[model samples]
Target chain A: MTDAPPPAPPGRHDRPLAPAGGAQAVSELPVVTTYPLAFTGQAGEYFRIWIVNTALSIVTLGLYLPWARVRQRQYFYGHTWLDGQNFEYTASPVALLRGYLIVGAFFLAYSVTANFDSTLWIAGLIAVLFFGLYPWLVMKSLRFVAASTTYRGLRFRHHGKAGGAYLAYGLANVAAGLTGGLALPWAWFMQRRYQVQNAAYGNAHATFRGDVGDFYVIGLTGLAVGIGGGVLLALPLIALFFLLGGANFPEAGGETFTPGLVAGLVGAYLALLALYAVAWQYVRAATLRSVLNRVEVGGVVRTGATFSPWRLVWIGVSNALVQALTLGLATPWAAVRRARYVVQGVQVRAIASLDDFAADAAPSESALGEAATELLDINLGF
Target chain B: MTLPAPDPLSLSGVFFDGRTSRDRAATLTVSAGEAQLRVDGGLETRWAVTQLRIDPPVPGVRRVLKFPDGSRFETADDASVTALEARTGRNRALGQVRRLETRWWTALGALALTLALAWGFVAYGIPALARGAAKATPRSVLATFDRETVQFLEDGGYLGSSRLSAARQAQLQTEFRRVTAWAGGGYPYRLLLRDGAPEDAPFQLGANAFALPNGTVVMTDQLVALARSDRELLGVLAHETGHVTHRHGLAGVYQGLGLTLLSVAVTGDLISAGTFAAAVPAALLRNGYSRAAETQADEGAGRYLMGTYGTTRPLRDILARLDREDRNADESSVRGGSRTEDLLQTHPGTAQRLRHLRDIEARGR
Candidate 1:
């Protein structure tokens, strides 16, 4: 594919000085190239891997969990591609087992303490300890995931510190709670900024510049529309209630409500729920687009995505419905569809040839935190 | 010099030097001992065929051939991949997996088999394992669990002081002990009474009577007041003993745990919206075994009650009355049926249980 001319940098570009010794310098014209990212993994292919892994895991009575995890990650990673080179997951099963052992110890201790004490104070202390350690765990888990992954032989790295993670997660969450949840948009922005800014492939660092104002604008607008739609939907019910007057109201602790009134209330509640989910899906899509469009690698390679929220909602709703109907047997196919839709919409623009980037000699990080989270069933989904 | 003769097995493809973003036309020729790559620019490379690693095809992806020294030959051409596969036999494991995945009949067969096996595992395997495990467990361990569970309930306001008088309580306990003696010391049973808190509270366990695996039976004050006679109370306690003996509660716990793990494996990510969607039904189905357990418990109660009263009439009467009371109380909160509540109910419909009791009475006669 022919490269598109890069958009002017506006204000962020810093031009380097030309050579003085008569050597011809490369042109400053930005070379914008969008690398196609594709998910080549198929449900049929993955199913074989899944069935085998599951059978073995069952046969081994969960001892094969580490190997199962590695194989699963490797299958997905090895099929996802950018610029014709697939990403790879390099974490060993042994490392994962070590992580599981550490986590299992903590779980055992907690259960024992809770069982023995059976007191409110001990329960509170356990919850407090979990929250206190959560930020550091998140940071370590991200680092572990990044360190295990590679693209074109170059390792990816996560550079955020635990302190920064605390500010992004713990402090931001507290602020959101204190401000009657008005700070949620700002909290989301900060968290995304922290995650994106710290990610790098070899030496090309990513930058996220999406303003918090954009987050609040979309978030508040979505909330307003949701509330408005719900109220509008309930107008008929409210009208019906008024028309029937107070005497027809259901008596407390009595099953005397008119069937019509009960059905109206239930229907309105279900509609309101559906409306909320649809609105949230839209807000999520718009926010994801805004965040992804602002990411730049090395101040030269920019990435973007186009997401139609309506399409996303349909996909989300249908996936849930189908999965439920099939008793979760359709899960692999649903995952494939979602991944394909999202990946196909992503675009990358770089100012120069991507070949000059060299592999970094970064050491692999421990998968202990990730394994712990996995075992605990705490899905960060990073 | 004239070009070397083209081997009949030579396959044309594109090669990536592993250092640039450029792709060059190349031909891979596998000879007697070596695999050689000849690029368009007269650049030639050779590797021992044994040292070459071939990656399998994924949908919409290039098949890669890796050299020992780290260069790569990537091609979208199916011919090149087949040529390599023909030289080195296809991976047996992957090939088998691929067959099950790609062939329509095989995929269908696999799906059917998987669903059948999963259902059997959930329905029977987990419960059987739990029965074995509960039997193997020491009584001391079960006692500890029971003690801790009761303490938690009391702390959580789920258990309260019984409004029943001490004299009346003693009368009920005396009957319960007598009945157990008849069954040859069936259980080391302890009975606790709970007052019904207000509805909608976390501990709104309305008129419920349940037995723990360790032989502790909790009788709600509402249930005791609802009983017409001491014979009715004896019938309920006898039923609870049946639960303890069968280890139904422990089996239910194991089944629930197994379902959770199985769903996790199916969904991969716990955060998926589908995870909760799928979990609710599976949990309900697992608890659906409660219907069977209730039947077993009822039959046990019937045998004892018939021996004492010469009829299962008292036990059946109490069950029918309690079922009516529960329906009225539940419907008072919201008129008509809730689909979720109907789906999630662990116990058999009270009508169904009463019918089974009638059947037992019929057979005994």
Candidate 2:
């Protein structure tokens, strides 16, 4: 292959090429073909790690999770490889810590402002602030990663966006929040624009597929499970009804209260529980799906991943329960679930022996090919 | 040689004229031991990456890859790639990555928190706020009263009117003082009048009485035409003094106007331009009298009546008569709703006020 990804092998079986100018003595390149990452570590190990780290983080109020996870990820990905390319895990302890502080500040501000009890004006103001700073954070994050490593001759570069550009997109999503599912388009638009506008590349341009299902699915699932669990959880309220109905409440005027009222209130509680579960499921599904589908790649172009909502929901609910009981300490469980689910439907097609860049699996030599081809092209194209 | 900052350091800038459209700005950094160049570009197209890779490339170490347009990035550790990316970090890969991840999550957290807050507010606070808002109609500034009231004086009196002109105000004040002084305090009379009313002798009212801030009084022409006796008229004049002394006139005006303004402002019920030209009327309506102001005016009138006549009996008699007449008129009339309150309620109405006066009189009697 003089330059460029060598055309697919004439036969179905093809392999990525070695760097041109050949492999120097300074570097003896591996010849073994790498496959996309697959779960090689025992699920229990991951669970243990996730449980321990997440619990500790939660106990610490999410203070050291990022750094802790960095180590954990490094350990996990360092051993795992797909298409000959291993997952690269890195984190700036200060950055992670600072970022958490910033995020926490944001959380506090948001809660307070929302609690202000004034509508329309406050919501609009905060939403604008929320979206305005979004691009800055996105760019900062990208730049940090870009400056962090060189993988297959690639590095993350800083990318910033126009003022309020992302905000407009986000507002579109908020507009979609109104419709039970009808507003999915707006939400998709919001995610798409933000992702596309924020993405950077050393190899290929990244874009968004913008599927409405991503939002609708999340909304419905979160609503369903969260609401459903809430309902079942509150099922004990029925006893309260019997207690009230079986007894009586005295009125201020010295009249006996109706038992039926107690029964009615019990019914209302059950109804509220139902609503809660439905809402929880809806949010869970949609949020996870949306996050999972957003992808950025530098080499070949592929759209995005799609997964069954049911699997995501189950994982989300169990993890969520742990998260709730432990006050989000079990978030890593959710992370694991999400990470696994995210990798589930993703497919990367690179040369068989060459690394598949798209797959989240353990093998990816495609980055090497790009660098080699880049060198060859500079000789000719430029 | 001093090398420039690593290639993948900058996210966006216009360079490399050929691929300007593609955002293919790439920077290279080669370390002493590890020869690597960090590549930052907008596109990682087949030709895009190929051109640079062939440049007798001093094999890359860890490379920080990024695109300007798309936030696409990767770090490759393929010995050569790692060598390249390492230039960007100079062996500090961990720091930058942590920063990046931190930034992303920080942003996510902010967005989530904000949304939650907005959602919570609209859900909980709005209903209560809406209820409060609904209570105050805040329409137009105007006087308001819970109930209509009226009082007729003791003597069978005629409600007299003052001339609307400025000069008439002076004349009426003089006339009242002369009559009462001559009557041996028989009729301690003073008129509390409104401004801008009819100047022709008997002032009339369609909606309300207009007693100005000054002692000069102007009864609505309606009031003037409503009565018969001159003695009764004297009583009416004295009654007007009661109002002036008590400053009930101001209270009446305030109730009629300032309260309405407050009500309108509170309820967001601004003045209706079509019905009343809000500008001047609003100005007129906004002034409210303090309770002390009303009491001061009442005392002034009371002292004049008591000091001059040396008796509160006449004032009491006047109040009782007015109360009966007011009740009869109010009940007997088929007048429109607006005419309902030709009242003397504010300055101790007929019953309690008379009783109070009689008591005061008893103390002196």
Candidate 1's TM-score? 0.80
Output the worst ten-in-a-row residue range by lDDT, candidate 1 chain A: A1-10
How big is the positional error of residue A220 in model 1, measured in Å on the Cα after superposition? Answer: 2.5
Question: Model 2: per-residue lDDT, tens digit, A71-95?
Answer: 5665354434333333444445455
Model 1, residue A340: distance off in Å is: 3.6
Per-model TM values vs. the true structure: 0.80, 0.36
**Superposition-based RMSD of candidate 1 using all C-alpha atoms, in angstroms:** 7.1
lDDT of each: 0.70, 0.41
Tell me the tens digit of each residue's lDDT in model 2 across B1-365. 24654333222221222222122334333334332333453433322332232111111112334333323333232344434434433335344333322343443444454345434433333323433432332222101111111112101122333345667556555766753453341222334543223434243333233333234444453343344433333445655555433434334442433333322322222223212223433333322123233334334445455655665554444344444545234222222222213131233233445445545555555
> In CAPRI terms, where does candidate 2 land?
incorrect
Runs of candidate 2 with Cα error greater than 4 angstroms are A1-36, A41-66, A72-81, A99-135, A138-153, A156-160, A163-170, A173-184, A196-201, A211-299, A303-306, A323-334, A350-382, B1-365
